[model samples]
Target chain A: MNITSAPPTTDRRIDVALPGAAGQTEAVAWLEGAQAQIAGRAVWSEVRLEIGAGEFTAILGPNGSGKTTLLRVLLGELPLAAGRASVLGRDPGAAKGQIGYLPQRRHFDAGIRIRGVDLVRLGLDGARWGLPIRALGRDRVREAIELVCASEYATRPIGRLSGGEQQRLLIAQALVTDPRVLILDEPLDSLDLPNQTAVSALLARICKQQGVTVLLVAHDVNPLLSYLDRVVYFGAGRAAVGTPREVITAGTLSRLYGVRIEVLTTADGRLFVAGLPEAPAHHSGRHEHDEQ
Target chain B: MSSSALPLAGLSLDPVSDFQQLTAFPFMVNALEAGTAVAIMAGVVGWFMVLRRESFAGHTLSLMAFPGATGALLIGLPAAAGYFVFCGASALVIGLGSSGVRRHRGEESALTGVVQALGLACGFVFLSLYQGVLAGYENLLFGDFLGITRGQVLTLAIVAVLALCGFALVGRPLLFASVDETVARARGVPVRGLALAFLLVLGLAVAATAQITGVLLVFALLVAPAATAQQITCRIGASLVLSVILGVAITWAGLALAYFYSEPVGFYITTVAFTIYVIARVTRAVIDHSTLLRRRPEIAEAHA
Candidate 1:
């Protein structure tokens, strides 16, 4: 068989047909009464949220509050037990390259030998099944690397890079598709302060430059406060959707926590929620601290 | 003279004439041809097998050859047919069994162990039921290349080409899934299908390598070269090329040593392969230690 004769069979076109197209600005994501049950009990009930195109929104919640489950529902990996969800005016999974996703932080094994650029290239056509004839999307891969400021170490093995550098490459991987919506899960979990700020700024730049809607999940919100246009904060089977100032206020958060929570803004404009429960027992001594 | 008493250790000192003598026989030529085909296929598949940390699955697939040969003897069919059928069937079994917990961790190994145990037990049962003496048993366990036929060499060549092509077709996506399954699945990559496809390709590679190296010694061809190459370099393309080169070099050396010293080829192959891997590991450790030492000045400057 001629290995390079055929284009990759996995290069199928996404079904992007919208249901209605009259004077409607297609939302990047929409969910109303989205419910997820665990052990026959709904962790998320009647959750309603709409993410406008090009909006940068943060999904915040304590553990077991279905923040990840919400992202999964948006990715169409999990079906809503109740209510409806749509992404780009179609089912979330209908389009292949419309949503760029950055999964939670995962460190590669030292033995994994893939380079930073190769990881970005995989996002280009990693699912396709054939030998690439002629350097397919070579320029696009280079552009994605440059976009993330990872060109200096683009050829370095992914395992050798620091956590922040690796996360940047992963962002480049997600951006390679030029997706309409970007969904990141806990992208800033282990980053130092500077790297977290840099990644936050980079993501803001991405949203503005490409008009890509961004849904970022994080434990802490202080680093993201400057860039967040909106927030969808879920807690205890309920969700609140509004601007950062509206959703992160003491009254809204105290009601969500079922306990008094103080949302304090320091003089430098960093917000930190105090008097929430302590870190969970399992997470007592870990490097990762729980969100308030 | 006992073959064990032959001067194998001394042959290395005067290797040029020994090498020429190894090429003197027609059987040696056929053996080399088969080894070359087997080496290339094993090298490519083994790189993925190691990368995916599916070496246990690979080992189990190689062992499927045992029952395959015994079953073939019972059914009056060629042993090669048994090897492919058994390996392919086991691949499906392992794939389906591991599907439940692709992300669960530790579950796949338990299932693989069960399948491997079942396969080995079946092999023994088949050997016991055979009415006639199971001749060539030693040859099946510790391979002999002295009687390799031209037809066998051609079969090896075809299987190698097919396996390599299949690997090439899925290599990019396979690496993507293998490295990061969660992100790949999120990006619309078929993570589960890729896993199953990789297992099937691995089965084919195991079947081909089993013919030349025997079931027990298959890892000498499949794991050692790839593992050694990985220890030496952290580049995908370079590691792959290095693995193929290492595989071929060791196979040729093993065949020549087995020919000159009159030993089982598996012994020479496994020994040499293990030695190379150990050398690579030592070299990596040394380089890492020195790099840490070299960075001490930078740490001191930062402190200042």
Candidate 2:
């Protein structure tokens, strides 16, 4: 494939009559009552959440909460016992090629020292196995490398790069397929301040510039406050979804944890929710939401 | 004692006679063909074995074939075919019998352990039943490759060809999934199917290696070359290619040295492969230091 950094077609008109277009901007999910249990313990009970198309949504939760489990169900990696769910108007697993996913903190084996652009090429060309020797038509591969700003490191081994560089490489690998929806699990976990800002701005640009919907799962919603379009708080076997401002409020926060939660907003109009039951000890300083 | 009657120990032998002893005899040729074929198959499959961290699976399959080979010998059938059959069966069990890897509670080695135990135990039971029924039990521990037949050689060739095809067919996906499963799956690659297929290919390779190297020496063929190659190369494609080249070179080189030195083939191969891998590791470290010293200016320029 010819990998390039060129912007997408100006027309953005895909005349191939792709599926799920009729349902554009519609809620991808309509769960009346969804539940998941493990060893007779309910992780999620009577929970309902709607994921809209073309929306940059963030799923926020505590460490042991069902945010990840919910994402697994959404990605069709796990099955729900009593629930109806759909992605892109089809079963989540069936809409496989249409979504891009980045797992949390996965370290590639040091044995392989592939370049960043080659990793991106894999997504663009699908997979090549058991076939005659053929490169991905060269040009597409170059184009994909460019699209992700990974061409500079196209020849550098991934292991030699820094952690933030590796994360960027992974993001490029995840997005090279031109997927409709991109899902990242804790993309900001180990990034430095500069990298956190860089990646957040990058994702924001891709969403606004390319119309690619984003779903980010993060435990620390503190970093994502300024850039996210909406927030979905998963807690106590349920979830609360609305605009970040509306959902991170005192009433929503207190109900989510079954304890008093105070949201402090600085003069800059950025909000941070703290005083939850899980971390009462770290309740001294008000968290700054716009620092990164 | 007469010179011929002296113990044939601590002495080098005539290289040509030793070569004849290894191949001119009918049984010796059988071993040569089998050994060569197994070495090639192991080289290719070993690439994936290293990638998947399924070296234990190779060991387990080698052990799992014990009963099948002995049972075949006890019934006066070809043990080579039996080994291949049993290895394939063990692979199938390992791939499909266990629940999904995600269900294994936060333990990476736990699933590997369970699969290893199942295969080892089943192999032990099979060997126990056929104990003392074969000509020599020690030969199984340290293979007597000279006992292999022409039919087995042909069979190994076919197996190697199939494995080569399998590797090439799934080379892209296998590498993709091993390096990054989430990205591969999102891009519509069949991660689970590729994993299962890899296990099966590994089983086949393990079976072939066990027949010549003995179950104990399968590690030498599967791990040593690939591990060595990894130390020397940062490129995935180059690493795999070099691993196979090194594996085949070690096998042939070891065989030649064994003939000249009258050494046991397995021990000779292992020693040579280990030495090469160690040297490669040391050389890579030195090269890294030198590159850093020399390329500082280039790094500064690139950043600018």
Candidate 3:
């Protein structure tokens, strides 16, 4: 401890870094040529990937591509059988609360009858069972509602809400604790265009303003191009990680998916990649807004 | 209706004087007192029942006690104590056996189904064995509430205190866990322990009421008032308080009515509670519809 001198300012501001942020932990993930076991059997081998801090990397691959499995490893929900996976410069298990996880799909306990505000309150501290919840508290609940811009239906029971409304409520719940790293698995499900815009905008704000590190699992990159800092393409039993502009080349796209691929910018200037081995597009130039 | 006015009553089993039945006898007072006390615990536990979506568990618990009660009779032990032991043990077993919420099977529902079957099986077995040896025990099965004594009422008072203390201690975590077990577990709560504690409390309560109303009729005191309160209210604290009031009234009113009739006491208690539940349900629906209608004016003005 240091004894302070007499110099004083009228006001002082202190900055706090977010979780999985710059300088808090070395943002480097190192993996050797190790096999990933699935269902007690080794389906793939010799996988290696490195992810650095402050990187918004979208992991993309074909269906059944193990992208979701890879997210689980990063969240420590699954054990890496042959390879070691590290998160926030430590084992993933050590940082569960520190990391925010949004799964591809989750069923809300329909029996849990509560308003959107109370659901978000569960995120703040009620997620844990032992602690008491004063869901009626004024300011904190208000702040959470405002943070998510979920004030409109804050008092609306979740059972009466639409899919987009529920999605926002889920995101608000995820953000209630202000986690350091936000990892989302296909968060764009059932979202409308406006909601998608609102969510992406909010995520970008969280990343930039709060410095929260984000790892998004998405099939397409159009909605995410502006928000993502990098792309991690996984295929043929390996992963390649770098910037979207660097990773979205025709060669990289074809190599990642193993098919004839085309990357096109829409008339609205949205970056879209069209490639799939099966389920050929009816039109060569079909507008497949992946999440919109 | 005469007290041995007909001489054939001398050959009958344990005939009672007609005058002994008309007044507020000591045993009748004890029955009403014990019934009301146990009903308080029922209200509180039943709040959790509605919250946790385990009203079915309430029915299953009453049934589960049947085997334990009958088995106690076979072994020549106090059926109430046996119920406590069996139901408590069943609670712990259910806890250890159940693999938390996320499961391929609905373990609680499955366990309840099994318990119901076992209860019926044991009831039949005990009935065969007890054809003549357990004439009064049949009355105990549905409860001759007029037969309740001061000792049982005192026991009910003690249990009411313990149940209240348990409620105060775990009230918050209990609601949180009931609301969402998976999320609560992730939040570092001992979710399984909370679940077990709640189940044990539930067992203890059902056992207490079973003394006055029997395992067969405990549901009237255990579930009816609480469930009726649920229909009219959403706030848990208010619902709990209302349920207790409703429970006490049901039993007290049933006791008063039993004073005037020759019916089984459980029958009156259950009928009163069920009637209250139906009335509350209907009234609540009408009130809610009226409130929506009342809100239509504001909605129209806002649109304008």
Candidate 4:
């Protein structure tokens, strides 16, 4: 089987029709042989994927594997070098209003004095000019905070909150817009294991209950493994999308990375992809050293 | 010496008479008008400048007023025109040269420092090149509230109004971009454009404030009130309003005291602003310590 091509047997490929027309299907995002380049170098090319409505998907890769590049392509921040990609049945940038996006986690300086609730409100009308009118969309902000289970400290200064608490508020901020598609970039990076699992479960529930398509980028696959409907693995200028079981096997991953990698299952049935020579041992270190 | 020529109306316990004495002369009235305008503009712009952590840039822009005034004098132009031209041009250079990303903040600070140094150097060069001794040179550095003309007050008022209008236009999106730039961009906020626009507004603010507090003590009106207000409250609206109130109150008090005593208005303004900042900071510390102490026992009990 050609691993580079789209999965032939899966029903996902059948939804690939017009670029900007999601006509009848529930496909929220569609990419056909899409390629993205950064600084004149192709980071990921020949990407073929279709994410349906209410589905929870994770984009996983080692550092410099172009997971973020792919997200930028969808957000319309970066132009696709070749092929076509669409979000919410429109061109990438055109459908931004319906797409809730959480950028990479950032530390709020302790001196930042804005209330957490105010931050959530910004997600609603932050793009609009003029001052924020009080009580406009207040209930929506409160509902979003309640949804994230962050109502306890929503009134406190955002900088004083813990990382997990801040992450929940940011998630609420993203959700306050009532987006049809939620794109979160490395939301679980700085959180502990329990918080990671909790946030992952929260995203999954949002996907199922609110019928919001969830696309999360992550480095580690274990916390999100069970909740993810599909996995889009990026490796050395290539991408593969399938169910976790299909795309994460040694045979598929080895072909994607062009190296002999091993997928091992622990006693608790948690799968670990080992033998990634290019992957950094300490992922956080890689982020810190990355040229901003 | 100048006060000896005018009636020495010292401040009294009665409030109405002190106000009457303060605004008795045309020059004093003009000083108050210009001070009020400058204080209001600085309070509003400085709140955002402090929030965005760009006080260095603001400081550098304030420094530009010196060279701008001197250069304008050398070329036989109005000092106010020089202040705006230099401050605005330097602000554009700093804003355009840096990406305003958090990662490049160190580089931004360096660029700000470079502009500040070059501005000071240009000021001294202009002073040396000019044939005549610069009249009111001390006023250029430490400010002369009594020297503020009615025309200057009008100019300051007009510039302050324009800056406030510009701020009102971009205030919300600017706050969003300042607080969280990456997500704001994704939400379709023009982050880069807002950064540039904010720098320009801040340039206007610095130029106006420098006329009152002078280049050396511009932070007296620009940063001190905003920093004090932010220390006291976390709410954006409350903090901003408090900043403006504190700024206006401080300016009035400073002007009154300078009128009563024989000192530069800048000295009194800086001293009062510093005192308020210290009080606010100490009060905030005390409250924070008490809250932490109160929470400790409960946290221990919960753990137990």
Candidate 5:
């Protein structure tokens, strides 16, 4: 437990040194003693964390445990109640163009007529006024679709595609801006097992090849366990951050949950948590009650 | 035939002569000009309104036209002024009450229904309080294209131009926000502001459209053509252009039919637009069914 305390003096020094440094090794997102509030009440407080550039991190927790809330705080949608937070060497939302975000899984209505390619293009310049110039941003849109391996059906209407295909195109949309930081919420919630693994591998590749910082929220972390550089687990207004080997152990999780718990490992090296009174164990092929 | 009934012109075999005859009257000329401007604006704005699935909100705004016009008549003002005031004000209320990324959609719909009910009630009250026979009351609900003056045509053109300019400024961002609001907001698009602006622009378009199609039949120019175009194409640019073309064609057809048959232009416009929407739907269904039939053999082979 090498948890750094409040008042991020080390982060301040790094900020001062950022101009001279190459910027690749800097912290992509820094949160010190951060408290998130909704409707004047604190959802979670006393959070201290720092994520370096290009690291793939997974946020795992039960429903209402503030995993999504932390992402929202970092996205600058929700203001922190107590502590300080910064991303990409600036305020939470000041450097938005350099960040790509995939929100919670949403099904496209069957009547939506926009093509998958156009939807991805919106991610690049949808905020701009006037009609889109067809020639502008074409190459990047193509590159993103190809990277996601969705070139075959990217021309089709988004509504007509299957869930997995739509998910891939949405990932392409998030990646179209060539962002340095990628934040996704429940990206794997409705995906099947095979699709879950494939999407995870794709995200891992993006992190390694592009050096993009990836912070994703998930319920079951098994699909992302092999690729994660670190894990942040939230429980009852508190959070624990460490490497998977350090954080997924019985001792750490039981202490975080304030209950007696067991971390069981399968013969194939998969880890699962059992003995939680309210929530089910984090197991594959079992559905957890969704609180969306 | 009643002495006051309009002299109906029979359709001649010569198309050019019929067009010349249709344009010969100043009132008909004004109606055609107003209809063209209204159609173009309605097509573009209505395409977005339908895309956002805010047609109900658009409908509520149109309903405001009734009260606006009658209230103006009661107060000794031009009905057009009433239309713009009531529609724009109600649009602001709806937009302000329900401008956010997600959630509260039920509340928005409920608010729209309430506004619609109040608008109708206000219209009836104004009508009863006027204490005079409001001649051409039927024309207020169903349009009176033949009664349009040249000044009214100019007003519609100006409003159409301004509304189209608004679209030019926010079209891309509006489309993005409408399609995926959460991601749009995450990417720094002002989702709430855009939503409110779109509602305001839709109010302007509705107010302008209600002038020609009247309150009850604004959907003739607003929803039907856009919906039909969407049903026919998946591409945004193509669908928008098609929607405009369909709207203009429907308006022209309704005008010509009304001139020849002595019927309300609103009824003719609504019928034409509805028929076109039905055709588009049927054609799409047929194409999809054939595609499925063609793919069945491959599925069977794969299974075997």
Candidate 6:
């Protein structure tokens, strides 16, 4: 098993570098020969990638393709079995709270007694022990809420808000930390088309404005295509990375899946892939703007 | 109705003087003091329990009271020591048994049920084997608030302070984890450690409250106030404060009603708590319905 791939070894980095600007274009998250272990067996192995700072990347994979496990590794919650994974140019576990994360949609119980702002405030100092002096943390929390456009429902019960509204609040929670890298797992799942687009655009804006790297895991790539700068598609314990147009092509995805897969493009430039065995099961019945 | 036939029963009907006469007894004063301490501890800890959806664990800890008392009688130790030992031990059993990644509700529930059953069996076994009359069975099961001694009240106060201070130490992180464990874990909150610490605090609360309301009716104090307050408000600080106030009110009023009616204090306490919870739920529903009714007109106008 390869333990650590040589540093300064990446296919994704810009080959040309300015003498004084090395830090600006460095890869925020780098994985080389990474193998993710589940139950002592490698579920995904030999993954190599470099995610640049301020880049918007989408992680696309079928169910059980280790997409979530890969995110967990970057969050430092999971250890790689036989590779090096560096986050923000340091050991991932040592960089706690430096990476803001939005997990999949989680609905609170109906009787949940918390305001939307409180949820975001937890993102700021929720881990701190004792009663939070809201006076000290309120300003930062307010800025986060404003950033996500969630001020209108900031005072409402979190469980009472609509799905789209709740997602915005969750994004605010993720942004409250002013993290260097944002890791989101299916942030747009169960959302309507408009909400999906709006959240994706907001995330892209944050990335551009703050120079923060974003690694988002999603089942489908259609909603995120417009804002995504690159794509990491995982299949059968293998990984591929490139621009969306490059990775989602019939030639690339078909070879990745070891099956015939069709990449369908609509008149409006939206891309969809079909003919994979799991495509039928993966298609959500919700109305989409285009069909594959 | 039979109370009317008693010669002195009619005198108990005056609400003001009846309250005064009840507090006139020294034992009643002690009972009130102990009840107040127990109510405060329960209200604070129970709010977190409900938020974490750990009511089953709370119930299991309360059930330990039965074995604690019976085993104390069997081994010649103080019942208070037995209560703390059994409760603290059971908390570890529940916490350690199910403390893993988030989303293991099935295994956690199974562990709670198993612990509760074994604890109840031990209580029954201790009761059968002890040769002396296990005289406090009624007290153990239903409680005798009026029989509380000064020492018991002091003990209750000390336990209340300890539990509340412990809560003060971990309250924020615990709240964050309870509301959203995934985000809390992602942000480096000690989610698993917080779960274990909360279970221990909940153990202290169950041990304290079981003395006042008994093992069977512990939920009367542990769950009712928090549930009622949550129904009325979604703000954490206000809801927690409201839960504490509601808890104290229910205990005090239950004590008074039990005095006037010559009934079991547990019965009055549970009934009053449930009644208040019902009122809060109904009021919340009515408010929601009215808001919906008011919104329909505006929605229609916008469509027009």
In model 1, residue pairs whose N, Cα or C atoms come closer than 3 Å (at least 3 residues apart or on different chains), thus clashing, are: none
* Highest-lDDT candidate: 4
Residue A97 error for model 4, in Å? 0.7
lDDT of 6 by residue, A78-123 (tens): 9999878877777767776688888988987656768899889888
TM-score of 6: 0.88
Candidate 3 chain A lDDT trough over 10 residues, lowest sum: A9-18
> What tier of docking accuracy does candidate 5 attain?
medium
lDDT of 6 by residue, B123-220 (tens): 99998998898766777887667668899999999999998888888888888889999888766688888898889888888888888888788888
lDDT (Cα, tens digit) per residue for candidate 3, span B79-164: 77778887787776666666647452387778767777777797679757754576466566676665566777887899889988
Candidate 1 docking band: acceptable
Q: Give the alpha carbon lDDT tens digit for every residue of A62-128 in model 2.
A: 6656677777777888777776667777776777777778888666555455666667666666475
Per-residue CA lDDT of model 1 for B163-219, tens digit only, reads 888878888888888888887776667778888878887888888788778888988
Give the per-residue lDDT of model 3 (tens digit) for A1-292.
1112212311211111122233325653334454565665443345555555555668776555557777767777677777556777788667787876666655555434456776677667654333354644557667756876779777755654666677777777777777788888887756777777777777777777777787888776767767777666665555555566656666676765556787666565466667644332321112122101
User: Model 5 segments beyond 4 Å from truth?
Assistant: A1-25, A39-42, A82-84, A277-292, B1-9, B292-304
lDDT against the true structure, each candidate: 0.81, 0.69, 0.67, 0.86, 0.85, 0.81
For candidate 4, what is the DockQ-based docking class?
Answer: medium
Query: Is 3 or 5 the stronger prediction by DockQ?
Result: 5
Worst 10 residues of 2 chain A by lDDT: A283-292
Model 6 chain A worst lDDT run, 10 consecutive residues: A283-292
Query: Each model's TM-score?
Result: 0.86, 0.77, 0.77, 0.92, 0.90, 0.88
- Model 3 reaches what TM-score against the true structure? 0.77
Point out where model 6 deviates above 4 Å. Answer: A1-25, A257-259, A277-292, B1-19, B100-102, B293-304
Candidate 4 lDDT over residue span A65-130, tens digit each: 789988888898899989888787778888888889998998999889899999999999888987
For model 2 the local lDDT of residue B304 reads: 62
Give iRMSD, candidate 3: 3.6
Model 3, position B18, has a per-residue lDDT of 34
Instruction: List the candidates ranked by DockQ, beginning with the highest.
Output: 4, 5, 6, 1, 2, 3
Model 2 C-alpha lDDT per residue in residues B216-259, reported as the tens digit of each score: 67778888888788777756678878888888888776655544
Clashes of each: 0, 26, 2, 0, 0, 0
